[model samples]
Target: MALGGGTFTTMNKILPGTYINFVSAPRASAALSDRGIAAMPAEFDWGPEGAVFAVESGEFEKRSLELFGYPYTHEKLKGLRDLFRNIRKGYFYRLNTGGEPAKNDFATALHPGTRGNSLRIVIEAAEASTEETPVYDVSTWMDDTRIDLQTVKTAAQLHDNAFVRFQAEATLAATAGANLTGGTDGAAGDAAYQTFLDQIEPYTFHALGCLSDKPAVKALFTAFTKRMRDESGVKFQTVLHRYGQADYEGVISVENGLTGAADDTSAVWWTTGAQAGCAVNKSLTNRVYDGEFEIDTRYTQAQLEEGIQSGGFLLHRVGDETRVLTDINTFVSATEERSSDFGSNQTIRVLDQIGNDIAALFNTKYNGQVPNDAAGRVSLWNDIVRHHQQLQTLRAIQTFEPENVTVEAGDTKKSVVVTDRVTPVNAMEQLYMVCVVA
Candidate 1:
């Protein structure tokens, strides 16, 4: 007789010693896991020329110089600095379709763009005390300071550094400097932006920032966001400048950009990042705008009100401070009977968080592991109740009654059906008071 101790879908008539199956308990997904990630596409001078790159907090300055050929504070990086003012992490993809790389005698620019034209390489004799059997001191310079150095005996021994790659099979020579030239920035077009959209499809981020004011580009982002959210179950919003009457919950249209600035649409960068960084249970209404750009307060009181009614995100002066009037998307209620709950960004955040968390929990813990029976259904229901209870405790939702949740048999044997209701909580944004004095 043979002993069996393995998993089987059906029982077999054979000698068996203990057939056991183990499954872990389902746990709630963490709400903070995917909060602060943002994505954007822009023209850059140095960095990965045509790919999606991840930049963590506090690394923008160093990475920008290492990849883009300039520090974050350089004039060329103004837009990126604005974008990173509030966001701690981001996914940046460059949109340079026909750009040219700067080159010199020893090496070529790692990426194409006008900024790389500033690169210069200098070769000197290495100090005798240095390690690695120093033969030559090869320095890569950007602007003034040396960014990278290498010691080698011959040109063939030289290796590529962070700034540039060395040329192949070149004769060794010492020169004061070799200046790179002819780098150019590509002409930005609709096709370049479309390529960005296609490359970013498989990524996950909380918000996407579109700085272009072109109507065609803005429409592209709107349609891409809708398809991703509706068909693919990926939920993320887009922030664009002056995109009037988009009327979609996933699109945040900025009515007013920065005033007294070279780039009028710079406000979109900060707004997009701030929205991505907002907490799950919080609202961005009344949040102070502390970015580098100045708010445009040209709207009168009536115009401001009209902007809000038409689903625009605006900042107005409030006692020497500029603050957001409401953190709302472009979702206008189509009918009197329809609820305007979807217009509030806080409501959407709560709902999206719930949907993402529950789906992740089920797919990871309970998929194909639990039987489609009363016991398994009850187990699932209990886990869901606990998850909602946690949300209620955190004040993200209210009135989550256990009895309102039900798990029943689906139309097929291997399917299960679940239905539940939830009321999202929003922060108090207005108050009316009456006082009488004698």
Candidate 2:
């Protein structure tokens, strides 16, 4: 039935059901440190009705599935309904493995039934601003959150295991005084040489670097660090774009950061955000907007050699090793193959309890006790059957409508002209009440 000329909204709700996890054979590895991996559990969050509500803003959050309100058996109904919906959205279907037309199908060389189904239908639902607000009952701000064609994995593991690094170089233009030779236009040039010597006098005699020579090394290292930072930024941005396009959004945290080292005349000074022997450059770690991000090691052979050769470098082994692991939650197509066909044939035995009622009516109304003889009883049974069939046929005819066809209307603005006409009632010799013709 179609309702006309108004915004028609439907609220489909699926009642919640208990969820169970089955691990047929559970196993764990001792060598995998203290960390462990587990499969993402399947969930069912049905609302008041049979419709499955989308998960919002929590651990599972956007990583939930959506289902229709109708109670569908695994085989006959759910798949068929999904197929029909796809067809309505212009997705031409082909037969799948079990000989049913599927929306997500392609004819591959090896398996001619597989295809990439990317067509989507965007529904405008209302999102809840708070827990008290009813989301399913509204019609604005809600977006589709289900991930498609991706596998699920945990992001916490990735944050722990991913590598990261940081480095920086000097801004020489801002640093104070080295040689300002080109600034002055002096005579003979000896005075300029003398001025240079005076400027170098402050630290020229020091064991490592005169204060004047320090700027050169700082500038080089700073530039190098800046380049590394830029590269890291680009790589992270690319990952964010890809994940967002795939409909995955989450926070990314990097651990164990690296701040660039400084080179001195006698040794290299690696900036340690933490104290000596603690993790260095830890503050470089940050919470990123993408689902995945990385941390890395930053070092240069030339810088290391320069520090070692100058007797400032100390050789010490890294006593502790921190392992990193990464995980991601992606959406992938899964089938619930509990039974090839889920529906069963039901036999509905509807015995008529109308015998007494019919007999009584006949006895009272027709002034008959209802004959008890075999032939008479047989005739009564036939009469009952005839009445039942007539009522059924009348009902069917009342409810069923033939396909519509266009017809001309002479004067009426609205009229229903059914092509298959019903017999008109003849009133010429019918009940005659006292009446006057206008």
Candidate 3:
């Protein structure tokens, strides 16, 4: 619908992580109507899937048909739908194995075309203006940041079952081999240990970042640092920080790796020396590593909240019954009243009110209210839980990783591993980052 006035413009847009707003004062026009239908609209709702506008118009009605007495319809922003659709699908961190352009990998692999990698918006005035309704416009653009395969691989390693086992076995083997005397002969255990390390080479993390924002970056840094501290098994001080400016700046790094012998080369040699870095490390916490992700930073606080709210992306293990976390923030926030029969009952009631479609899926509800039975023996309830988790992951990535980098060149050397600040659960869109001892 059109808002009537002498001649004016105002608009606002909300991108994934940022918001932009604009307005124009009423202008003076030579032509004036005695009954000038001046209107200012505040907001408009178009259902759940439709775009809602909270506008302040000079002359408009919330449900006005036409100020000029002609039929009118609001202009549908095709780009908005396109952008939101991509956001809903979320971004992926695919291992660019083909050696093509990484940007192309990101652009093409994550749903080719239609503003998937980056976003651009424009706000411009249409025609003449005066003192009263001065022409006005507003525009904004938001994009997702990108990291390298190493980052994704490393982060994934934290959750990788096989990789964790391999690292554990390798650490023990290396330790045992170190105690063995003489070069006369190496036992099978030594060989096996070395093999384990070799196998781990391809799965190592080499880069790190928020995958989009500083907060995400901080969360990952905190999580990994804590994990390393708990598992490093070494006794040494630790430190991490950033340096530099402009495009050339990156994270600083310095950490020691454990060695089997004194004369042997240092096992922990990583990017060190203040080189305008993002994070740092000192001493080798533990050459041996385990699988544990942490979230202890204000930056990651929202992320952790989002991650938890997103429903954990996947139901790792589901039995006949599962404790589905309806609201992770509330669940975690609670001290003694997190999960209540009353609360659970209320939630199920709301779901039931919505329809039997949902109620049919859940049986044996947690509070003895909602059903907990898996329909038709297919575990439909569990499936729905898993779906919500995936949805949560997608939403988290979209909300937190709006500042993703788009690596256009996918060549091997050009594909320098970087850290993904955010981790989308999607296999392809998941950000891969490396931790270069930084």
Best by TM-score: 1
| RMSD of model 3 against the true structure | 33.2
Give the range of the ten consecutive residues with the poorest summed lDDT in model 3. Answer: 33-42
Better of 1 and 2 by TM-score: 1
Q: Rank the candidates by lDDT, best first.
A: 1, 3, 2
* Of 1 and 2, the candidate ranking higher by lDDT: 1
Highest lDDT among the candidates is held by which one? Answer: 1
lDDT of 3 by residue, 206-269 (tens): 2221111233433343444334323542111111222111101112111111233222111111
Model 1 alpha-carbon miss at residue 30, Å: 6.6
- Backbone Cα, N, C clashes tallied per candidate: 4, 36, 70
Candidate 2 residue spans exceeding 4 A from truth:
1-123, 127-272, 275-315, 318-438
Cα lDDT of all candidates, in order? 0.81, 0.20, 0.22
2 or 3, which is superior by TM-score? Answer: 3
Model 1, runs deviating above 4 Å: 1-32, 129-134, 261-263, 336-338
Q: Which regions of candidate 3 are displaced past 4 Å?
A: 1-202, 206-213, 232-438
Order of all candidates by TM-score, from best down to worst?
Answer: 1, 3, 2
Candidate 2 lDDT, tens digit per residue, 72-141?
3322123223222211111111111221111211110111111112112112223432345322211111
